[model samples]
Target: MIAIDDILEKIVSKEIEKKEALRFFEELPEKEKSYLVSKLKTHLSNNANSVENNFSEKKERTLKAVTELQLNEEHKGFIDQMAQKLEKNAPKSKENASECQTYFVDQRRTGGLKKALKRLQFHLTYSECDGAYLYDIDGNKYIDIASDNGVNLFGHQPDFIKEAISKRLDKGYPLVGYTEELSQATKLFSELTGHERVLFTQSGTEAVMWAVRIARAATQKKKIVIFEGAYHGLSDTVLAAKDQFGNSIAMGLGMIQEFADELIVLDYGNMEDLSIIEDRADEIAGVLVEPVQSRNPNNQPVEFLKEVRKLTLEKNILLIMDEMITGFRVSCSGVQGLWKIKGDLATYGKIPAGGMPSGMIAGLTKYMNYVDGGTFDYDDESMPSVKKALMAGTHTRNPIKLAATLAILTEIKKRSSTSENKTDESNSCFLQELNEKTRLMCEELNSFFKTKNVPLIIEYFSSLFRFKFLDDPNGVVKELVFVLMRINGVETSPSGNCFLTLAHSDKDIKSIIRVVKKSIDTLMKQNFFYISDSIEEDEIKEDIRSTISTIPDMRNDPEQESIKNDQMEKLRKLIISDLNNFQEKEVTI
Candidate 1:
């Protein structure tokens, strides 16, 4: 028996490629090969920039294409058939990707990008994806809503996208240095979005990096004004502006404090703060803002955007819009059109690449095109800091990915335009049902809270929604929300916010709602919350009405000091009691 370490050492040490290693492992027969390789030791770098570029793992739908509905008699029958198949041809773990999975698992355990899902659990696996479903290690299916976080917009292995890639493959090399496909794709993307020209980069962070460069080039300014609660990607220069809670990632080693020192941070949608920026417009190159704050709060009001536009125009500073998440999912017209604001440059990614690593910087000619030749081309290929600007890495213009990109944009428009962009038919027939289900679940909980007078923020936007357990993150309900969603086959990202994909059917939404209701009932029973088992709609309505009734009547109440104090005291006591109760039922999530 050739030892497993001997085999993997040969491979990792460059003694053999993956194909050669596979052949060598094939001769081992049984779990012997897998078990051996799993024990081999290795190390991965945690330095921020040393991490493999993952901008292309765009969000994707969270399920499988197996057409398995709520485990009824029909699915039960399919399970029996599957059981028979398994009995006849049980998969030998040694013959699978056990080695690769093990490597990532061990590496992620030490804090790498591909964090291990579980030591025993298969959170990391690779499989051929087709259509709306995602297949994992053991062929388990999940309905992806974070659309792989916005690529694969038209779905994985979509026929149109696949055919396009196939057609491209039939031709010669799809990418040959810097050429026309880049420009043509740019034109198509820009034409649709109402931008004059598009500058193609390979990831969202790259788009952000270039946006700063363009602003610098046009204004001859050294500083950029970024929002406090924004994420333009993990580029070195952008690290100063932390994410929602302010954990400074992208600060591993290469990112010096001086680099972040150049970026001026401002609050999101603070119109008056523009005066601070306005007083320093000569020094400030541009104001970068996300149209909708995705993930953290995942909510940006339209009025907030209008104020941003007004302030930027008044200050005569460049306004760079980061629309990475809102481009495709928010509306067919993208963020600017959805919110009625204009931007000099719109940083795009997520869905535009069809689940591929890609990014685009779209802007007008006067400012965007300035950096091409007439300005600083300070060696992106030569200098380390600048190298990122020039490097698209391998497969930047992969024919397969391009084909998928073209298909996704076309399909999204077709579905949206024909039905007038998420019409009653689509919503009532599909998304609305899911949205209502979620809304109802939250409504039920909030009603109970209102009766208890517990303050909560049950945020919702269209079919995408998640209740932030801010009142008490230590509570059991926060953890149950994740566990129940997974058990019910409605898996969402751990990041609190969720986006509903077209792959999720109305029936599936109902199932999710059923699971949520049951989960809520469970949590209540566990005293995770103090909601009653027999919560009635009338009681809920009355609670809502009473809450509304306390709105202070600003028109009549010139002296509302007593009301404010009373409300504050009520809130304070409720919070104290809730936290005490939470301590008894909390799970250390």
Candidate 2:
């Protein structure tokens, strides 16, 4: 086997560029390369786990080595190549049924499994993903718009994250209990969320369950107030919804009937509806909200949230913000920092785990103390009986998850601390650019639909967007549109929820607009969307002109910018005034 340390030392001593060293390393036989990587990882881990007295010394040396070995463009390109090679050998899908059948029972709703196969004329059995793309079993490639429900922040197979996790694995995975990684993750969570205390869980649902229990225990109240269409979790208590008359009702078939009595479901975004909380303030434990409602993202009224804060404060009710989907997606501090409304407690998951499965319950010390241990003064007769909140699981403090979380938090803080004058190459600036590109994509989609006199529109909440159809006269046109999107090499959920990640470039966004336009045209040819009047040769050309207008000059070239602007004006005329020219021509799809 090759001496990994010798190679590393040579790279650090500037005898060879990091890129060239990596190239040499990649050219080795697979078994040898894997052996060399494992050895290096083990060497790093042993040094990392040294005695406390020598820890700083070891860390300084390790950091120096890592700085020299840091990945550059060539290294990332090599990693992507390796990822693709691995995907090339992925096992074939089962013959009789889709792979989703083995994992979930309801295949129809789970990312268009059976429907995509039968309707879209193809199936996508993914082998691996890297950054913005998914590679399937048959070697087909597709750009992922869904982002596995928005879990990937920097995208799949990020080199820095992979290295960090590999280093932790070399130290040995602590599946049974806590480790220094767990402590580090806790400290990072506290610093990032501004929460005084924290608890870990295996999934978002567990975090929500813990938050509700903590809220109830801390306030000594039995009933909780929740908003309609707010998905806190699958827990019995949080599964209730507000009916037409604003009464709490269990949403699921087998949900506990009595759970409704423990909840007060109110219409979200309706300030007047919150008045009911005033009457029940004495009995209410807390109010659970999504900050930006998942169902209605376009209407995140700041006034409503401020009123929520004021009402909760005046009535002495706790506020629990569920940032499961909105946590890192919205901002580094989640919605609390974005909207500047701090809550008594917040539940986070999704991107908080760095594409892994982990959840967090964070809150004030007074509230979190109910879950953590402490012996009260039993001798004090005035003390009320404290109902301890149960919030532990076998996977609560798994070291692997903690390491991934630490990596994510470290990157987040590092990116956020960059100077304001830095260019877009910085991660924070790139995130801002990503969000802007997403907003522009949404705007372009809506404009294309309206210009062609289609009934569809796209709406967004931060980087998350969903498609909306004004009228699906064919009863299945919406599903057909989704199927068309899949055939066009983009994956999205059936509910039309799409997400944008930091991995997505301006080129990716442009491709999305072009793919969507192609999908719309395909659906029209298949007689999908009901176009009242169309079918002129000039109309088709006009549609192309409209799409071309949406493509911006992201290359920073002045000539290209001017050309794009002129095209935008032509598109405006074609869609706005010239659209009248097609009103008289009758065309049916």
Write down the worst ten-residue block by lDDT for model 1: 41-50
Q: Candidate 2 residues 1-589, lDDT tens each? A: 2144345434323344544554666565433343343333323232232212222232222111111123346433433443344334333533313556677675334332222124232345677899999987666677888887777878786887888889989998867856887878888889867788888899999898888888888888988888765777678878864422234555545666588768987767777867778877998999999988765566587888889889998987899999887777766667787778999999998787987888898988877778855435767744433456766688888787888888988888787777474432232353566678788899988778655655566768778887754322112345456655655677776545689888887888888899889877765554443322212422443453445435543322355656645644454444333323323332111
Give Cα distance to truth, residue 210, candidate 2, Å. 0.9
**lDDT by residue for model 1 (1-589), tens:** 2245345434433333445554555565333332322222111111111112211121121111111111246434433443344333324322353565545455322221111112212133436565555665555565555456545545566676677667767775546565344555666676567788776677889889988887777777877877755788878777663321111223333456577667776667666666667677778888888777764444475786677677677766789988887675555446677566879898888777776677878878777656454234466653222212233446656655566566666665455454543432331232234446556655665555334332233555544565544323322234444544444444555445566555556565556556655655543444434322222322332343344345443211337647544654453344234323433443100
List candidate 2 stretches off by more than 4 Å: 1-96, 99-123, 374-387, 421-430, 473-475, 531-589
Q: Which clashing pairs does model 2 show?
A: none
Give residue 65's error in model 2 in angstroms.
Answer: 60
Q: After superposition, which runs of candidate 1 have C-alpha atoms over 4 Å from their true positions?
A: 1-102, 105-132, 178-184, 241-254, 296-298, 374-396, 416-458, 474-477, 530-589
Using all chains and alpha carbons, the TM-scores for the candidates as numbered come to 0.62, 0.69
Each prediction's whole-model lDDT (CA): 0.52, 0.64
lDDT of 2 at 39: 36
